[model samples]
Target: MSDAATKSDAAMKPGWTPRSAWAGILSEGSFGAKGPAGVTATAREDLGIASLIAPEDGEAALSQVVKTRFGLDLPTTPRTVVLAGRALVWAGPGQWLLVTENRTGFASDLQALSGLAAIADQSDGRAVLTLSGGKIRTALAKGCMIDLHPSAFPVGSAALTSIAHIGVHLWRADNGPNGAVFEFMVARSMAGSFWSWFSASAAEFGYSVHVGRG
Candidate 1:
């Protein structure tokens, strides 16, 4: 191999770590309207993310593989399910985004389904953020057209929506003591633009940001 290739490989080996998409954009701290913060956005880059796509002819088989491997069924519609610390969020007709915390070999594990479907590593291709607080819904309502009311987009609901013209895969992870905790998955390239819309929307009340280990 060329010297350049060898150096590039070594630089990104073991000790090397990926940087957060929110670096410089989101710092760990409280900001905005001063008083008690009404919203909090946590950058969850520590989470491992991957894309699962089933071939039209292999959808059924792939679902079985997933269930056997992860002990969870893939959602048929826009929804999310957590089983064994992993979240399978429906992305489309035959696609789901798998998310987990502290699972470094996430994508490799998903490879077990490769015989039935395609698995793409999205740990670096996507930016994951968890937004929650008393004003979380209101803040999300500013740009999300879909109704976020519990009666509609209840906990475990997932949707492929747009925020400020940017495409985002959103899911209601859980109902926190204060309110629903929502997670937003967006393309890495659009992270900055999304943050701008998010921060501005939550500024009316107050928001805090906690950067994660990306």
Candidate 2:
């Protein structure tokens, strides 16, 4: 192989281990495991997050651009939709958040598109946590005031809400045999606090904490 190819391969090699914001608090111990029904919350760091802001008059055009680039349309309502390897989450009237697992450099790619959209990388600015199990909704109800009934916030629904006064971008990512799996994206600074609140609220129902990459 050429020297340039060899150097490129070397540069792409994995390096030192990186730590997530929640690394300090997440432990691999059983906290709520004695109950009949239990919840499992996992903290992951492998998700890429990006915020998209479109111009007042550029919503339609930007939506098209997103569709053309990601093979997914921007969700117009408060919902989450996934296509290929990415998810488009409605954040506001004209704004959306882009998320992907194992997809890096997305923010830069989004920014590169010439349009009325403003793209910002939030992969490091936010922490993602996934909650699953039969009692997931019940546990979240302790602090979150949203109606999370299967009929209300059904799978693929996304909402900008608050839990214990901390703002959170929440969505029902999956629902099947394992029950509902809710994903929470919170400010990195509030990750520890959010986890604390979630754990405490889930204690009565019996829960397990799993920490890993997205």
* Best model per lDDT: 1
Every candidate's lDDT: 0.85, 0.84
lDDT of 2: 0.84
> TM-scores, in order shown?
0.89, 0.86
lDDT string, candidate 1, 25-136, tens digits = 7787888899988998989867778888888888889878778888989899999999877888999999998888756777567767667777887887888898999998
| Residue 58 C-alpha lDDT in model 2 | 90
- Candidate 2 lDDT, 81-156, residue by residue in tens: 8987789999999888888875576656566555668778788788998888888888999989889998999999
Off by over 4 Å in 2: 1-18, 33-37, 105-108, 112-114
**Could you give me the TM-score of model 1 versus the true structure?**
0.89
Worst 10 residues of 1 by lDDT: 102-111
Q: Give all candidate RMSDs, comma-separated.
A: 3.5, 6.1
